[model samples]
Target chain A: MTDKPRFKSARESGYLLCIDCEKLHPLSLEGELCDRCGARLHSRVPNSMNLSWASLIAAVILFLPANMLPIMTFKSFGQGEPSTILGGILHLLDQDMLLIGLVVLFASIVVPVLKIIAMTILLCTVQFRLQTNLRQKTLMFRIIEWIGRWSMLDIFVIGILVALVQLGNIAHIEGNDGATAFAVVVLLTMFSAIIFDTRLIWDNGVTDLPSDNSDEKDTP
Target chain B: MHGTPEQLIACHECDLLMTRVANKPNEDVICPRCHARIFYTSINSIERLLALSVAGLILFIPANIFPILSLQVFGQSQSEIILQSALSLFDGGLVLVALLILLFAIVVPLFQQVILFYISFTLHYRREGRLLRQAMHAYQHLRGWGMLEIFMLGVLISIIKLKDIADLHIGLGLYSLAALIVVTTLSSVFFNPHQIWHQIDLRRQKRATDDR
Candidate 1:
């Protein structure tokens, strides 16, 4: 690893790739629009960290009501019982639908909380420029981005149930306020992840550190 | 502009600039520093993309036209297609939520399929230039918005939730939706944007020489 030549980043080499057109342009055109497609050219996303932090904070605040309030209310013969996310999972478990229960548990509860935590860590690590575990951090960021969308599973379930189970006063299903909050939480976290630029994680890698003897010796 | 297309390959992840080396089909060119896949020579990619997109198009009709699932309680049954659900949500005063579902689950996926089909058709027929580039850009922009598979999983969970309260019956729409999800995913996997761009560049160069 020490003997290999260090790769120069586009930023270091004075070029920026247009995210829209994938065309490489000189860095002198940074604030100016892309000549090829007229899209804004930036070496990195502008205000990425600040925007990510704001969205993540909003998502964290919304997560409480999303899990606590009833997502769906079930009515049978004029008697109604509203089910929170945890209550719904426990109900499934009690009914011996272990597989479905676990799926809901993982998709609804575990995934969102884990996604929030992951985003917070990634944003903080990048903001503080912690050089340790940069590779692992990038991989974590990828995994979070990929799985963040799965949390929408619960919202979809609510939409379908609210539509299908409307039997008019006898055994009806109606979506409660929590469903909306849950949906917003999912969307906010996703936006936060997207707003974050994963390339920043590797900005302060070993190559950018103070010159060591190994690096000096490797340079011919 | 300064180098041949083969010499212009830059790793989007690590920004490592290197000349493109010849690789067999299905071989991936990975960035040495970041281990990100820079490009891959996908075998028979255009055909695979076209077939998958067509399959998704075929499945899209039944996925929307037929009832997704039917619920029966006390001998009274209610069924709805995906669109009706969104319409009902609109009626229920959840307009934003309704539109969100409609956009992500229905509209965006269909638009993505159409874009994929257009690009694959153009590529297979050896038509290149501005239209192909526009389609490629549209596909990239629309790629992140489609969530058909997530919607299907949500329907599955909904069915499970309804099982205890009523007689739940699966519909043709459900089956078509399952198939549609599979087809769309396969289409995205087989569609390589970099390869399509390379093809476009090659055609442009050829046309330039012919004109000269």
Candidate 2:
């Protein structure tokens, strides 16, 4: 954990590390191939911004229907009750299961929203080339990648309940449109995170500038 | 490492180029600019990874087959297995959601355990038959899709959600699934993907020299 000044980027030094295999290839080489693993090499992930932005935009559109529409319908004695994402959380809290309630609220609601917002901010930072708070933004991106999968919690819950709660007519659970939408939302966001190139954050509008950081001599 | 030229490593997060340092066991090299991990080391990596994957595979069947919980409602008790989670959803006509659940909760995790075991076993013995690179490549791709731990949490939350409505009893599958989650997470925490790549490269090098 030593903090030091930035140095020459591999992009500027004219080499690329294979994102798949970590094999380094000089950028000037024609037909760049990862000599170690043979994955086609790219200096930066090609079309990273476009791919991530496309995925993120789709996720943003899906997020609404995912939350608003009923995910599951619980029926007891022919009486049907449908619950949205927020509705389910409120139901859990109303049952006085404080810890479980908060966990659901966090997983089902908070995490997805946070992930969406964090990804947007990171994308904007890259698009606008905002160098301030780059480290924190990168850290946030890491956390986003790790936590993105957990947003599937709600879908899994619906799956389990839909499977388990079928007791003929007395009580049963049925999956709905929201579950599908939510599942797609989770997948899209995860893809956006995966498609995003973290290195793009550090380019910091300096891809064209020939001045590499000169503080390498004195800095630790 | 002995006869190779000095390697230059680039930070994946920030793209800063730095000369690679051979890491001691369990050492992690942190990127100076963005504090991302540049190097991750693991001791007995292949053996430990294989052990965990084998353990996960052993638990996989029972974890999916046995009832996660049995519910008692109006004196009629019924139990639900983990696979039913996906099967039931598909029956309900939420085909995509069902398939996603099937993929994330059951299929992908099982595939991961098998692929991991295959990759590690092949890498450990330096066995030749399968394409090691493609196998390792698939293993890396599978890592993102498997959500075993998240599924475990969903199990717990579902249990709590249904607790008030019915008398629910926890079952063998839940216990096994919990163990599976612990084993997989532990293996992931201290893994060295590069070590696997390096070993495969060594094997290639050895074969090349033998040809000469």
Candidate 3:
């Protein structure tokens, strides 16, 4: 295989590429709209870190009610019981549906917590301008982004159940407030990941920004 | 067409900018800094994309038409189709949630597949039209909203959740939905955005030269 050629960042090369039109423009036109596609041009997404942090914080706050409160209430013959997320998983386990239980546990509980934690570490490392594990961090961000949508699995399940099991008070299912909270948590985290610019993680690694060097040292 | 000051491209992952170079078919131009794939020249990409999308469209019919799951409790069995789940939710007064499921699970995915088929078919036959740009824009915007795979997983979880309460049977619609998910994902994997954009650019350039 032939060795790939080395590259400089658009920031370093004094140019910005329009993501929509793929047209190249000089960095001097950063604040101006793209001449070809009418997209606003920026060498990097402005305020990416701040937006990610805000959404991430909102997701973390909502994560509690998503797990603690009852996601749905099961009513059978005038008797009702509310089931939290963990309760539902354990109930499935109690009935010996191990595979489904494990799948729900992973998708609903494990994945969201892990995503939030992983994103936190990623955001912190990038915000602090740590130079270690740049490659691994980038890969982690990609995986997090790819798997983020699967967290919606629980919401879909609840939605399907609430619709399917209604038998007019014999065995009806009603969605509780927790379902809304859980959906919001999923959405906020997705927004957080979307707003995060993965390119910033590598910016401090290879490129030398003479102005930002002092700010980098200030944190460390 | 050989060497016109190779236009520069930026790496979406690591922000590395490099001059674009022509690649032989089946060659990938990977970013040097972060090892991310920048672009590639694939052989017969349009043909592969068209085939996969058409297959997905066929499967989508069975996915929505038949009952996804049936529940039997106390000698009364009721089967629920994909749309029924959303309609039932609406009856239960969860209007917004019902719309969300319908949009993500059914409408958006169908729209995405149709758009893919349209773009690939048009490009393969070299049809010139103004709708190509709008189609490409819609594809990019709606790509993230297609959640068939997530919905399928939800179906599985629901089956298991209802197992003890009622006798649950997976219907033909479930299998078709699964197949549709696989076909749509394969189509996306084969459909490279940069390559399609390059084709669009080439067509525009040809038209400009012809006009001149």
Candidate 4:
């Protein structure tokens, strides 16, 4: 409240104290907020880290089932039948799309699973109060979290096939239990990441510190 | 009526510093320096919002029931049921697509919508129930599973190619399924989860005071 600076709008009214000089500077209209003090006037989303982690966990869980279950049933000329996760990868191989097969295997199967495991470890470590490789874990988590949603390509393929391939009773497609489970797993992981509080990961270490006047004075 | 403190708030985009005050702006407030918007608690509604969400649940049944798509290749014609598609994919040895479709098209949507409705219903109508928070968390977890758009894309591609071969007929189920997608989207938009949580907190406080 001492030496409070005047501003145009309450929306714009906040103290922007520089970490280096410890002086208050008014926010600029050019960029986001004051660069020195990092005073933000507004926010984008709430608990983003929590949301990201929650989504990541849900994605990982879903990834497991997505690969384990049968995504779609293909009836071609009444001769085809349902395909499982590995079955589809093999089918791609059968279709001579080895590269696509591998890609699908890695993206839909490998990457997603790896991401889930990686995120789980990262989030769990932070959540459970065990922090060793915080930076590396966080970086890896970011990458996995970023690419997690794209793995839905396999699910998309199934949806496409189900929508198409309806040639009367001669050929048709259907979805099965496995597919539903897989989808749930994917969604669960996504939401897990979305709901998880990433900042909580950072908070476990500092929360136990003493809230004394000396500590408060040290910030200035 | 306690207000959130300044230190309690942070930038939504970058987690920078911000002062917390009661009744903050609802949307589109950016950080003056970083230009990052500082989003406080997201607008969330609880089981009460389920009243609005039931529409999505009702539409979901049709989304799954009717033929999502149909096609005719050459003189012969066929229809694809979601369940049958999974079976056929397994039979055809295209197991991956089969599994993928089941998960994205059927499982995820059903899970998300049902869970959401369940949570919202329990929270909104049944005031005395516990574990409402857990339900909200579960709903948030499952809501992303609905992969209607991705499924639609696959169907669209099939239609484009099938049209070259024979007459293509997309059924009422498919249209209803599409409408179901719209309904779910609208439900998410209209029902705010954070608001619901706030209401619950307020009620809890009021109840505690009354008990005291």
The number of the candidate with the highest DockQ is: 2
Q: Write the per-residue lDDT of candidate 1 for residues B1-212, one digit (tens) a residue.
A: 33224245556654555555676888887655556777788889999998999998889999999998998888899997888666766667667677888989899999988988888888788765366766777788777779988888888887876777679888999999999988988888998877777677677778889999
TM-score (chain A only) for the predictions, listed in order: 0.90, 0.89, 0.88, 0.62
Question: Cα deviation in Å at residue A177, candidate 4?
Answer: 18
Looking at model 3, residue A88 earns an lDDT score of 92
- Can you rank all candidates by lDDT, best first? 2, 3, 1, 4
Task: Indicate the residue-level lDDT of B163 in model 3.
Answer: 78
Clashing pairs in 1: none
What is the Cα-based TM-score of model 1?
0.90
What value does the lDDT take at residue A107 in candidate 1? 87
The C-alpha TM-scores of every prediction are 0.90, 0.93, 0.89, 0.53
Instruction: Give each model's whole-structure lDDT.
Output: 0.78, 0.83, 0.80, 0.56
Fraction of native Cα contacts reproduced by each candidate: 0.37, 0.69, 0.43, 0.18
- Can you give the DockQ of every candidate in the order shown? 0.42, 0.56, 0.40, 0.09
Instruction: Please give the range of 10 consecutive residues that has the lowest summed lDDT in model 2 chain A.
Output: A211-220
Instruction: Kindly list the per-residue Cα lDDT of model 3 for residues B13-127, writing each as its tens digit.
Output: 7777776767777788776566677778777889998999999899999999988888889877778788876787677676766777888898999998899999999999888
lDDT of 4 by residue, B3-95 (tens): 223243443322334454454645544443224333334444453346546776787777667776666566665666556656666665556
